[model samples]
Target: EEDQGLRFLQAGTALGTHKGMIKIPVWDCKKNQQASCDLSHRKNMEPVPENDTGQPEWDEESDYRACTYCKDNASEYLKHYRIASWFELIEKTENLASHMIQRAAAFSMQYNGGNLQLMCYPRFTATVDDLMSDLDELEGNLGFVPDLIILDYADILLESGNDERERLDRIWKKMAGMAGKRKVLVVTASQGTRKSLMSKSIKTDQVAEDIRKLAHIDLGIGLNQFVKEDERDERKAMIMRLSVMVKRHGETPSEECFVLQNLGLGQPAMDTYSFLRELADSWALLILTLIFLGVIGWAYRPGSRALHDDAADVPFRNEDPEQSRPEQSRPEQSRNDHARQDGACK
Candidate 1:
């Protein structure tokens, strides 16, 4: 896949070749590298017939160079130098990409444990403009636009125009523009300057190509892992620190968090263990104070006096039903009875 020269590879399901679906996938690797074959058809580049001029023409493309053999000396060598090597490199790169994707998918399903549909549309060697165009083509082919587009990395993109800084600015500006225009999130990474490697923290200035690249991003996180000089990977479980360099709408975080990781083994994410243990302790103390205040307020609250009185009378209630009833006086009835008794005696 490419656009720099006439050399290209086309990707599609035509002629019993690569296949793609119209339905949107749950997860997608939306990217185009520096060189890419458009999704036109599954075929190689065919040179157009022209006048028999001994000019150098599109022969083949390799990772290192695009080997262009003159038509007159086409048979003088094996098509072009390192023609076979180009295919071999392509094979290796593809295999690595597939392997990493498979690992990530398996990890997501097994460890994360969710039903997810994954799709990868990989093309290589395209500039920033080519990437945007390819995105349009990809959406049109899929019949649905992707919610997210993850570029492989921005630094490797082919340069355009005259100025170096301007080229870098254009790349990022277009990326931001695409995100807003298409209403899709664009995620890309950039290489860091040499000084950033040793620094415990990363800033916008630490970014390579153009420090102004940070201006376009809404949110930016800097990954810091202390790697020593001439150090070899011992396959140990190392931790990486995350610092928030920019926030779209909120204040930048002064705190950082640590991620237990071993990316080489395809194990990157784990539960975050915060570096602000003291801050956590302070918050815990504040929560306990609130609970104490709540309890004190409940005991001394208004209208609680009646409830306390009812509770106090509960223990004093009589058990005998007869004693609990009221007794009535009958002095008039006694006097009447006495008078009747005297008359009977007389």
Candidate 2:
């Protein structure tokens, strides 16, 4: 809707009644002249009661002049009278836009956090290269990998049974592995066929149930609900698709909502499983390394010349001549004493 001031300016009229007295503001159409309110009736009105000797107090707020009766609706007149300029309007608009963008960014960061990585899977019309490029863009917005991702218009692949479906399945299967630490949500419209038949193109019930177990949200809207027969059925189909997409993927346009849930808690579960496996492997390696190092140290040990000799080798040291010199010297002394006694007897 157009602003009220803008509307009044365009129409060039302000309709107002004060206490049953009607006043019409007149604007000079000839020139952009300044407008002033005619206070003839205000002059007729009695003044406030005060002491005869006392002067009426002046107020800066009340001193401001009101708009003229004639040009009250005139844009130029209102601009001057209301003290609103075009530059001020432009400034307000810019500030409002900035505030809105900042608010959206803050809310997204608060809810999703930085740990969550968000990805988008557009329709099969997008190629692998296209997907990768889009992924880069998404990462730029998030500043990190997303813990959750959305497959937008996934039904497009279902339409084509060949390579497109294969590619999507492959990608999604890989994504599911990551889902232990992250999540992937797919959004699509439900087919209007009979639910009794197991062959409906869109299995809304089954997908919803499965996704719920996976902790992914699925929202399906039936196409038969909206009444837009005046336009092409494609229009109705598009709306159904869009509504389904928004409910499951979040944010109507892909550009608008780029954030995904962080799922940091999911990481701990993945870490626990990984850590146990790593710990087991590490324990095995540690035992093997200790045995190998012990054998090497035993083999490389200084055999006989070590500072601390082995107990088995200490016997050889005791058998050495230098180690038994005291016993050998005692035998020599007996021989010398025999020789001396024989010489003395002679």
Q: Which candidate achieves the best lDDT against the true structure?
A: 1
Tens-place lDDT per residue, model 2, 17-134, is 1122222111121111122223341211222222244322222333223223223333223322311101000011222233434644554566556654434344456543454466
Best by TM-score: 1
Please provide, for model 1 over 114-193, each residue's C-alpha lDDT reduced to its tens digit, 9 standing for 90 to 100: 22223233443577677677667766765546777777676667766778789889878888998999898888887778
Report lDDT (Cα) of residue 177, candidate 2: 46
Native-to-model Cα distance after best TM-score fit, residue 259 in candidate 1, in Å: 1.2
| Global lDDT of each candidate | 0.51, 0.34
- Give per-model TM-scores: 0.48, 0.22
Off by over 4 Å in 2: 1-98, 101-105, 108-147, 153-224, 228-346
What is the C-alpha local distance difference test score of candidate 2? 0.34
Error of 1 at 229 (Å): 7.5
